[model samples]
Target: MSEEIGRVGGPKNVREALLISSETADRNRHEIYEFGPFRLEPAERKLSRGDEVVTLTPKVFDMLVMLVRHSGHLLEKDDLIRSLWPDSFVEEGNLSNNIFVLRKALGNDREYIETVPRRGYRFVGAVRQLPPTGRNAISGVLEGQIRDVPSRQTRRGWKILFAAAAALLLFAAVFILRRFRGENSASSPNSPHLAVEQRLTSNPSDVPVRAAAISADGKYLAYADPTGLYLSQISSGETRRWSLPKDFVVFPRSWYPDGAHLLVVRDPKHPLDSSLPNPSLYKLSILGGEPQKIMSNAWGGSVSPDGSRIAYLSHTNAGDLWIMDSDGANARKVVAGPDPNKGGAGQDLIWRVVWSPTGQHLAYIQAHYRNAPDPVEPISSLRIVDPDGGGASVVLEDARLGPVALWWGREDRILFSYREDPANAQRNYGVYSIRIDGRTGKAIGPPQAVTRAEGFIEGMNGTPDGKRLVLWRLRVPAQVFISDYDPGTRQWKEPRRLVLDANENLAWVWTADSKAVFFVSNRNGTWKLFKQAIDETSPEVLVEGPSISDPRLSADGTQVLYLSSSNPDDASFPAEVMSKPIAGGTPRVVIQGKGIGNFQCAMAPSTLCLFSRDGGDYVFRVFDLEHGAGRELLKLQHQVWSENGSWSLSSDGSKLAIFLDQHRIRFFSIATGAAQDVTVKDWPLQNGDWGANSQTVFMPSHSPAGVPVILEVDQTGKAKVVLQGKPNADFGWMIQSPDSRHAVLGEYIPTDNNAWILNDF
Candidate 1:
């Protein structure tokens, strides 16, 4: 019997029985099976309870089908495994895992599949099979019975049937109407507007606004634009600049409920010093008075709807949420951050906490630790919990990189800003809203996009009525400039703008001959590699694609290596390391993985190319371009922050410099798997690259007092300022020539950020 069951060709009687069973199953494939309120269709591979379809994995669905095929009969464990995973070997644990997942997908109907202890499983639920026209046949018989009886119950049934038919007709009509309107809106110019935005403050001097807030009554707006705090009245269109102490810098965070006082964060330490004063919260009055300190060590805070208590974020090992009385008393931690001692998984940092309208719940952002097997991407979730730290749950699990600003609006919805393309900084940021589940503190409906605007929406606030919104729009213009740096004199001179097209042009590298420069730009809508000679004004396109980044020229100057995304718009697309001839031809893929960034090749002495792949921690590899192979050299002890741009390769490609957390720099040798830490007096390093001698690294450092300076650090970590930026000017990434005599730096062109009020949002 076992042989007959397993063999394809068997005895005549057995073959006939098997063929009959197969034909019967095929004939009933499209038939609907009903058990209780659940319905299953074998042909569609779908299971539904009344109107909602339940999602299931492919294996689980197959297992459910097998169980239902043998309903009321106990199937042995081995038989079930053979039936489900017939072609491969699988552990009993996998079967059990699938059963568990299947039960979860079944929800309340999980009891239908009963586990027979020490043996197998059984589908105990009584199921009835129905033909294609079963419902219509039953309805026709009911109509005949009702006509024969002519009772009140029959009349009531007829009324219910008519009502349901009307409802179905109405729903179909509405769905068609919505589809028609959507199609027309895509092609029509006179479509209905969803939102109207108006710019509030236009500074003639082009000072970029940092943090902004609107008053509760929507009558006044306060913002910081590098200089100081400014207050503007919406009704009068008059602006007032408030004076501050010379040593203190204030960033407006939130406005007091009373509308007369604003909550601000102050930094009082000297900008050039290495040590900074702890950020403190204060109450600055709009009526012009000395600011009064409220909290000793807090940066962001939000007041309750009743203005009685405040929820604030305090800096510890990681940011944590805290609650305190309005007068700064009875402070306590509510949401604990990740512990430094506990290494993997649950470690998360909290940021951007905001209170619900009734102050019953607080929503914040949590960044989780990077896990292995997947690429190192920024993993964040929007979470909500009780103010006293209870009933916590994640509302949105895949929040992208941005400012993490969230505002609770009407109808229990939260509006937030996120970036769709983490690789392309030039892409527009979008705003989305998700409905909050009141009972479980989770998100209920799908997130709907409100708008996608150019640049970034840094800060957002809503009026008391939740009808008007104020947002800060920031656009930073980046351009490449060539300057001469003399390592001997430690002076920078004759800085000239290299690219004048006004789009973001960065990640510039010199060719082996130092005659031309190669960089990545998004001037043509998609990120592509472009090259131009040192003396030329125009750049020629080298490689054009939808998702290309981190361009590198090989040591022989014959090939250009870069990371290309199969689908740039899809975050799950794994990036591939591709190499193409510098002169131009078909590109060849070398390595395939996630989180591929920051690659370099030796200038002339060697043909080694170094690249880094990020999983949880960064793994650096050295690839021999000639042999088309590579090996891992070292892995970082900690995960590199994606936004920091922390790793750099030396010109000779012998040593790699990595800036790690806790103000530490690691100089790793490629030949030997040895690393040495470079100590720089606890100075925070932004971004830098190696000098021509390969012994010193030139990096940008900002002082505690917010002063930006270019520093040259030796192999031993001794550092000295090579170039000082203007007091308030922001310095971007810096790249140098092979001889260290010439370099190009990104100096941010001043951009004016204005606060806009969006009505009917």
Candidate 2:
């Protein structure tokens, strides 16, 4: 009976054989697989629905592939864990999180994956082998059926085939033509234009335009660079520099509604110092005159639409949002941030407040503390509150790395600038807008992109009419440099560029042998570890993956330690400390936690490494790698804006030198946990590292003329100038060799920025 229905060597046999051969070829090639409407390409490490690609994290993608590979079979939890995290210890919660994210990515077809209570997971969906070239498997069956038809049916089959092919061709042609026309209509030179962009400032010196604001009348622009404040007439292109008190530095924040006066933040001392006392707000007129003080201890301020009230942020232990009368009276805190006594863990800052045009509401940005658990949820957010501080709510959460300028536009829309990926914020920033649902104080619509500029957008402000936007574009290139220090002459030789790359190359440390240096760079889109010999011109890749930071070499010259993360764009992703052999090998997980910062190990006789973790406070821990154990050594009070390299390990690993708040340094004994303050009269140390013999620490200082110089501070709080940086250069992140003969420094080349106006944007 089976032979009568279908005989061997007939058309059906040929088709079956062809399909079997195709399946064999697919398995050999390890190409795409099909389950329902989804196609999984194992070779490409990608999944797709028809022609659209799906995005997934590295681990999540791997888990999905494993499930599909063992379809119809239950995968034990232990088995799955062994397969996914083969080299490291991962908690069960992490596996559950991946499954949850995978289910969400699968959308409506997530039911294909089933769970057995307290057992494991099973992929029950029917999956088929697909051709390596992505051809439809059903099409092959159809072709076989047509060919197997009797002689009399051949003409009809051919006609049907021709008609179907013609239809598909016609549809494809129409789609292509429509797409071409749509693209051309939007950007073609012949298209009717609605707006034009104009360049306002042509700075020949390449000095960055630091802060900028547009006047209410939209006729003038006020900007500050390294030199001083400058006023420019937008229409006539005339510019004039304003004269101010000598040595006084100020940044332009906002303008008065009348357009003739501006609100600025002035710092008589070091402008970059976060703990500067009473950073006062002043009103400077467009015409030359002595500035009038508006309020002390305030920074970013915005005038109300009617100019009756001023909303400003006060710089204190707890950053507070305050509102006062136009003349700086009746100041009251409207939004209170984290309390100083509480360590300001998550609720640290309120940034860049702006009053709405109607004066009924005020909007501002809030910064997320770095030590969060969700990895991506706490970068920054947008909030809207009633001017009286009632009914305050977050309008947008997890808005990527901000301090982004906000402008309330027509139709209740709030426009701001943000980078799509916070990990690459240095290169990408675009303007986006979302409308607010007024009654609920929530975002109404999805964020729509206004412009994706090529360069970085530093600051943005819109005109009163909301027809133009003034913004600064910046491009900075940083390189690594090495200098020779002569202990005999007590001087440093001119620094030579060490690692030459267009991308940022930041120096981390010198090898224990002092023959090569290791650094972290983003030249390949993700920050990775690279090493270069002292005499080499180019660097060789040492470790490549998601993102790496704070590379450190072990004191015994046997291991290299660094902090790494799978999702570098998200701060909530806990950074794990990993170590490998100095000569190179598979990296082994050493420490796993959230907010792991820079680390340092003892140079010679000690096998101890000291690292810091940011929770509510900066906690320092000592890890004994040889014993495979760690213990908390000390904890420092958290400062809102403390530098990452604020602590260093002594050479013998017996003590740690920590820079504390108020320009103070503390020497803590590692053995007894005793602490003593080392007083340096008036020097504000920005960056420092321990010198040879552990008796003195090398700290970078600036001369009165602002030239970079290095000062060696001894245990007795005495310091003297050891090396001075070249004129017109900035030195940061100093790393000294144990022998004290060579030093590696981070030299920041000034980035050129230009101001441009986007008309009708």
TM-score of 1: 0.69
- Residues 478-597, candidate 1: write the lDDT tens digits: 667788866577689756888867666765578766677787777746677888877889988888776667677778878888777766434467777788888779888877766666
lDDT tens digits, residues 50-159, model 2? 89998999778877766675454455666567667766898888888888898888873235675543446666566775543443334443546765656758778888
Q: Highest lDDT: which candidate?
A: 2
Q: List per-prediction Cα lDDT, in the order shown.
A: 0.69, 0.70
Alpha-carbon shift of residue 61 in model 1 (angstroms) = 70
Candidate 2: Cα lDDT at 140: 46
lDDT of 1: 0.69
